[model samples]
Target: MQDSPQQPGSTGPTGSTVTSVDDPWVPSALEQERAAYRSARTRRSALVATASTLAMLGAVVALVGSSPGWPRVKETFFSWGKAVDSFPAVLDGLWLNIRVMLVCAVLIAILGLTLAVMRTVRGPVAFPLRLFATAYVDLFRGLPLLLVLFLLGFGAPALQLSGVPNSALFWGGCALVLSYSAYVAEVFRAGIESVHPSQRAAARSLGLSYGQTLRHVVLPQAVRRVVPALMNDLVSLQKDSGLIAVLGVIDAIRAAQIETASDFNYTPYVVAGALFVCLTIPMARFTDWVARRQGFHGAGGHL
Candidate 1:
C-alpha cells in the first residue's frame, strides 16, 4: 500500500528539515562559543589549582624535612628551664621597647608632618625648605638603620653633640624616629594629594586662604583616607626596631642574644621571638581593624 501523503509543514523530501531550526541538538554559534569558552576555562582552572597545590605541598615538605635547624628549635621550646629563668630579662627588655617605640612615634609624627608640609608648599620663598625636607627624607631613608644608629651613637661624641646619649636606649629611639619619619612623610604627602582638587577650588571660590582650605576641608578627608596605611606603616616600624640591636640596645632580641652568649643555648632567642610576636600582634590586629573600619579601601584609595 502507498504511504499516506505527507502533511503540510512535516519533514519530507519537499520540506527539507532545516537542521539549524528543526534539530534541538544543533546549537547557535554564540551558544557554542560560550560553551567552549566555559569548558576551556574550567580545564585551565583545574590545571592551575592542581599545580598550586603541588607547589605548596612541596614547599611544606622542604621546610619541615630538609631544614636542620627546626628540630633544635623545637627541642629548645620543649625545655622550660632556659626560657623560664630568662623571663625577667625579657620582661625588662619589653619595657624598654615600649618606651622606645612611644618616644620614636611622637618624634616621627612631628618631623614627618613638618617635612610633608614643606615638600608640598608652593612658591620660590619655600624652595630651600622643600630642598631641605627632600634631602633629609632621601638621606635617612637610604641609609641602613644600623649605620644611622652607629653614627648617632659613636660619631656624635666626636662632634661634641650629645643628641644620642651613651645609653643604647637613646640611640635606638632616635634612629627609629629618623628612619620612620621619612616613610611617614611620604604617607602624609599621599594623604594630602588624595583630597579632591575641586575641594581646593571650591575653597578658593569662597575666598578662603590656601592654608585655611587645607586645614579645614582637605586635610580632614585625606587623613581619614590614609589612616589604614598609617597603621600598617606603624606596624612595620615596630618590627624594624629589632635592627636597634646593633646599637647594643638590650631590646628583646639583644637581651636574648646576651643570654644565648652566656649559656650557649638558643632558647632565649626563641623566647625573644615569642615576645616579638606578642608586641607585634596588637599592631597587626589594629591594622586589620582600621582597614575594616575604613571600608577595606586601597591605600589612599588609589586602588
Candidate 2:
C-alpha cells in the first residue's frame, strides 16, 4: 500500500495542520528593514570590539617591551629555550594537579552536600547536627586555606600516629577537602533553601517521605540551580591544587620550583603558570557557557 500525500490545505509550510500554505505571510518592508538594521548593528559592534581589543593588547605589548628591564625580564622569565626544556616536566607535574583537583572535587561535593543537608535538617532531635555543621562551616570558612594546609601537612606528619599515613600529600588533600567543602556547603545550602517551601509540601502531599522528597524532588532542583557555582568552585580547585606544592608534593609549581633552582631562571615558573592558564581558561569558559545555557542570563530566556 502507498502512503497518502499531505494535502496543501491540511498542513501549512510551518507544519501546522490547522492551516494551508496557499496564502503565506510575508515580512513587511519595515520588518525587513529592522532585520537588516539588526544584522548591520551586530556587525558594527563586533568590528569595534575587535579593533579596541587589538589596540589595547598592542599598547600593553609596546609598554612591556619598552621597559628598562625588558631584556633581562624576557631572558629570565620568557626564554623560549627554557620554556621548551621545562615543558615536559611541567606538563607531567600538572597531571598531579589535575588528579588532585578531580579527587578533591568529588570529595568536596560529597562532604559539602552532606553538610548542607545536615544544616538544613528539622526538629530538636537534629539540633546537634545543625550546630556541628554551623561550627564546622564557620571555622573553616574563616581560616585561610594555606594555614590549614600547613597545619595538616606539617603538623599531622609530626604527630606520627601509627595507623594514620603521615604523607604530606595525604594531609594536603585532606586540608583541601576540608577547606573547600565549607564554601561548597554554603553554595549547596543556598541552592537548597532557594527552593520554594511549596515544593516540599507538594511532594509530601503526594505521600513522599521527607528523605524521599529531598532525594527526588528538592535535590534535583537544588543541584541544577547551583551547578554554575559548583563549577566555579571546581575551577578554583584546579588552580589551588598547586598550593599542595608548598607541602612538598612535587605538583606543577613544585616541579617548577625545582627547575628554577637548577639555574635560577624563572622561565620554568612562567611555563608552569602558562600550563595552568591552559587548564583553567577552558574550564572557566565552560562554566560561563553552562551559566548562559541555564538561562540565568537574558540570553537563555529563563530556562
Candidate 3:
C-alpha cells in the first residue's frame, strides 16, 4: 500500500522525522509565567536584602541609644550647638592642615622618586648613593612618624641652628615630608620594579640610554600600575597631617583642643574629627574608583 500523504509538519526525505511535537521548543504561557515569577523573586530578594541591612543598622542604633552613658555621650560629643559653635575655629585651623598637606605632598613625591631612582641604580660608581638610600629607607620606615615630627619640631630648633626656621608648623611639615617620603620611596621602587624586564631591554635595543628608558618607557607604566597604592599612602599622609598638632602647630586638633579647654566639653574634638573624615572620605572614594576603573580596563584588555 502506498504511504499516506505526509502531513504539513511530518517527516521529510532526509530520514529525519519532524512532527508538530518535533518543532523547535518555544515557551508556552505557563513557562513564561514561571519565568516572570522567578524575576519577581529576584526583585523580592533584593528588597529583602535592603530591609535586612536597615533593620540591622536600626538595631545597632537602638542598642547604643539605650545605653546608660548615651545621654552624656550625646550631650558631650554630638551636641549640635557645640558643633556649630566650634566649626568656624576648627575650619580655620584646617586651612593650615590643607596648606601643609599640599606642600608636603609635592615635596614627598619629588623626594620619593629621587630616592627610588637612587636605590635602583646599578653601577659601582653609584654604590655610596645606593647605600645611603637604603639606609634612609630603613631608618625612616622603621621610625614612627610622630617621633620624626618631635625631633624635627623640637630637637632641630634646640640645636639653635642659625638658618633653621623657628616655626612649629614649618618644622612639623618638613618632618612629615621626611618621614612620608621614605615610605613613598618604597612604593615608587615597588612600582619601578613591577615593569617587565623586557620593556627595558626593548628600549635599550632601540638605542635609548638608561635614564631615557626609565623616564620614557618604564616609569610611566610603573606609576600606572601603582596608582592605587600611591593613593592609599597619600590618604594616610593626609590623616597624619593631624599629627602635627602634637608639635603645637595650631592645626585642627590643636584648635579643637583650645575650644575644648574654653568650653570644658569634648564636642570640639568630635568636630575636628568630623572635619578630617570629611576631607579624607572623598579622597578614599576617588582612590577606590580609580582602582575599579583600572581593574575593569585591565580585564577588558586581557580579554
Candidate 4:
C-alpha cells in the first residue's frame, strides 16, 4: 500500500510539501545563512579575545621580568621558599578571617535590616527610632572602618566596663558590624524604597498591618533586589576581616607579618595577598553571577 498522504504540520519531502501549509516553522535560507554568520563571528571574536589577552599578559610578564630591579624584587616579594614556609600559617589564619567574616556578615545583615526598617517606619511614634537609626548610620558611615576598629578594639578594652568582654577580637568584630551595617542599611533602604509606594498601599488595602505587609511583601522584594550588593559587601568584609590583626589578633595578615619579620622578605605578605585575591575573586564573580541571574547589568560586561 502507498504511504498515507502527509498530514498538515507533518514532515515530508520539501519539494512535495507546501512549505507554509504542510511543514512546521523552519529557518529560511537567509535566516540559516545569518545564523551561520553569527556563529562564525562569535568564534572569531572569542579567538581574537583569547589571543589579545595572552599577548597582553605575556608582555606584562616579560616587562616585569626584564626590569633592572626584578632580581631583588623577586627575592623580596616572590621567594618560593618563603611562600612555601608561610603557606600553612597563612592558611590557618585565613580560616580565622573566614569565620570572622561569616559571623560579622550575619550580624551586619540583621542590624542593617533593623536599621533600615526603623528608618522607614511611618509614624510620629517611631520618630525616636528613626532619629536614632539616622544618627547611627550617619556616624558610622562617616567614620573610617579602621578608626572605628581601633577605637573599639583598643578603647573598649581600656574602658574595663562591667559585664564587658575586653577581647580585641570581640571588639574588632563589633566595629566591623557597626561600620558595615551602616552601609548595608543604606543599601537595604534603597531596596526597600525601590519597592514603589504602591506596593505598601496595596498590601495595606488587603487589611495587612504595616509589619505584616513589610514582612510578607516589601521585605522579600527588597532583600532580593539587594542581594548582589550584599554579596559585594560580604566580599569587602572578607578582605577587611584581616584588619582585626591590628588589635593584636593573629589573623592572616598578622601571620604573614610575623613570617616576614624573620628576614624582612615581603613574600609572606604576597602570599597573604594572593590568598585574599583567590577568595575575593570567587565572591566577586558570584556577585556578578547573581546580578546576571536577576537581570541586572553589572559594570564588568553584561554580568
Candidate 5:
C-alpha cells in the first residue's frame, strides 16, 4: 500500500523534527568561539615557551664560553693545589697592603674631616682655609695619582722639609692620603649639606649655638646620607692601594708580578685579581644595601 502524506509538524526520519535551518550538526556558536580561543592561547603559549627556552640556552652558552676553563682555570687562576702551599710569601705582600691602606685611610679621614669643616666655616680665617682647600682639591684631582705618588716618593727629598725624608712607605702613603682626602672632603661636605636647612633654623630659633646645632643635629643626618658614598670611596681606595707598588712598596699586585717574573706564568696576576675582587665584592654589596635603605634604587627607579 502507498504511504500517507506527512503533516506540517509531523516527525521525519529517525523520529526527529527540525526546528530551524540555522541549527546544524557541526557545532554551536559558543562552542566554536571557545575552540578558537583555546587554539590561540595554545599557539601563544608555545611561542612564549620556545622564546624562553632559546634565551636560557643562549645564556648558558655565553657563561660557558666566558669561563676561562674549569680545572685548568682553577690551576691557572688560584693554583690552590701547589702554589697556595707558599702561603707565607703570598700573605706577606697582602699584609703590607693592609697596613698601608689602614694607615692612609686613618690619615685621610682626619684630614678630610678638617678640610670639610674649614670649607663650610664662615669668617676671615675661613676664607683662606677655603681657598687653600679649593686649590688642594683642584691640584690633586687634576694630576694623575701615579705621577703625584712618584713626585712625592722621589722628589720630596730635594726639598728638605724637616725630618720628612723620601721614604717609599712614608711618601707613598702621604700621596695617597692627600689624593683621597680631597675626594673624601667633598664627600663629607655633601653629607653635611644634605642635612635639611630647617634643622639649623630650628636650632638657632631655640637659641642653640652654631657648633651645638651642627654637632647635635646636622651631622647625624649628613652621616646617614653619606654612608653609601663613603662606602663606595672606601672600595675605590682599597683598589688604589695597589698603586703603592709603584713606589717599591710591595703590595699584592707587585708580589704577583714578582712571582710571574719567576714562574713565567700569568697565574699570580689572576690570583691578585681574584683577591681584589674578593675585597671589593663585599664592599659593593654593603654600599648597595645602604643605598637601598636610603630609598635609592640604583640610578633610576623601575616603577
Candidate 6:
C-alpha cells in the first residue's frame, strides 16, 4: 500500500524538506534584508559626516574672513613672507631647545627611577629614605613647575655657588629634571603598585633576593606598564623646554619674541609655535601607539 502523503513542510527521505529555523545552511530573507539595510545606513552616516564637516569648516572660514580685524591679523600673524623670513632664526634657536630637552629627559628618567625605588623600599630600616622620597615628591609636585624654573634659573645664580653652572640653559634643564622627576616617580610608583603581589611572591619562592626580584621582574614589568605615561610626560617636557626663554636663553620662543619686537609682526611667534607642534606631534603619535599595543597585549594577558 502507498504510504500516507508526507505532511507539508516536513522532512522526508524521498521528498524535499522545508528550511528549518535551526539550520545554518539556509540564509534567511530577514537576515539578508537586515544586512542590506545596515550597509545603506553606514553609507548614509558617512555622507552625513562628510557634509557636516565641510559645512562647519566653511562656516568657520567665512566668519574669520569677514571679521573686521581679519586683514590686519592675517598680515601680522599669518603673513607667508614673514613666516619665510623668520623660519631660519626660529629653526636655529630650536636647536638649543632640542639639546636641553634631550639632556633633561635623560636626567629625569634616571632621577625618577631612583626616587621611585627609594619610595618603594620595604622595611623599618628604610623608613628614613622613604620619608625623604615622600617629602621630595610632595614638595616638587605641589610647587608649580614655573616657580621651580624661576627659582632654579634666577635664584640659583644669585647664590653664586662656585661649582654650579651659571648658564640659564643649564639651570633650566636642572629645574625640569627636578620637577618632572617627581611626577615621573609617581607614575613609576603607580606602575609598581599595579603589579600583582603573586609575582613578587613567586620570585621569592624561587630564592631570588629582594633586589634581584625587583631588578629582574618587578621593574621590567613596571617600566613597561608605565612607558605610555612616561612618554606623555616627556612630550610635556619637550614643550616646557621652551620655558628656558624666560631666563634669556635664546630658544625658539625667545627668538620669536625678538623677531616680533623688531618687525612688529606676530608671524614669528606663529612660526615658533608651528615648530613646537611639529616636534611634539610625532612623540604624541608614538605614545598613542605604545598605549594601544600595551592595551592589546594586556587584554590577552601577555604583559
Query: Which window of 10 residues has the lowest lDDT sum in candidate 1?
Result: 17-26
**What residue pairs are clashing in model 4?**
none
Candidate that scores best on TM-score? 4
Q: Which residue segments of model 3 deviate by more than 4 Å?
A: 1-42, 298-303
Residue pairs with backbone atoms closer than 3 Å in model 6 (clashes): none
lDDT of 3 by residue, 1-303 (tens): 897767766678897765665568889899999999999999999999999999999999999999999999999889899889999999999998998899999999999999999999899999999999999999998999989988888888877778778889888999899899999999999988878799999999999999999999988887887788889988998899999999888989999999999868899999999999999999999999988877776422432
lDDT of 3 at 182: 96
Superposed Cα RMSD, model 6: 5.1
Model 3 alpha-carbon miss at residue 67, Å: 1.6
RMSD of each: 9.5, 5.9, 5.6, 4.4, 14.2, 5.1
Q: Write down the TM-score of every candidate.
A: 0.72, 0.89, 0.85, 0.90, 0.70, 0.86
Off by over 4 Å in 2: 1-20, 23-25, 296-303
User: What lDDT, from 0 to 1, does candidate 4 have?
Assistant: 0.92
Model 1 lDDT tens row, 83-176: 8988789778877777777778778888887788889888999999999999999998899887888888666556655553566667667778
Local distance difference test, per candidate? 0.81, 0.93, 0.90, 0.92, 0.80, 0.92
Model 5, span 79-142: residue lDDT tens: 6643564444556777787788888888988898788877877788579988998888888888
TM-score-based ranking, best first?
Answer: 4, 2, 6, 3, 1, 5
Model 2 lowest lDDT segment of ten: 294-303
Off by over 4 Å in 6: 1-42, 299-303
* Candidate maximizing lDDT: 2
lDDT for 259 in candidate 2 is 91
> What is candidate 6's lDDT per residue for 1-303, written digit by digit as tens?
999876658888877785556656656899999999999999999999999999999999999999999999999999999999989999999998999899999999999999999999999999999999999999999999889989999899989999888998889888889999999999999888888899999999999999999999899999988899999999999999998899899999999999999879999999999999999999999999999898877522554
Model 2: lDDT of residue 83: 90
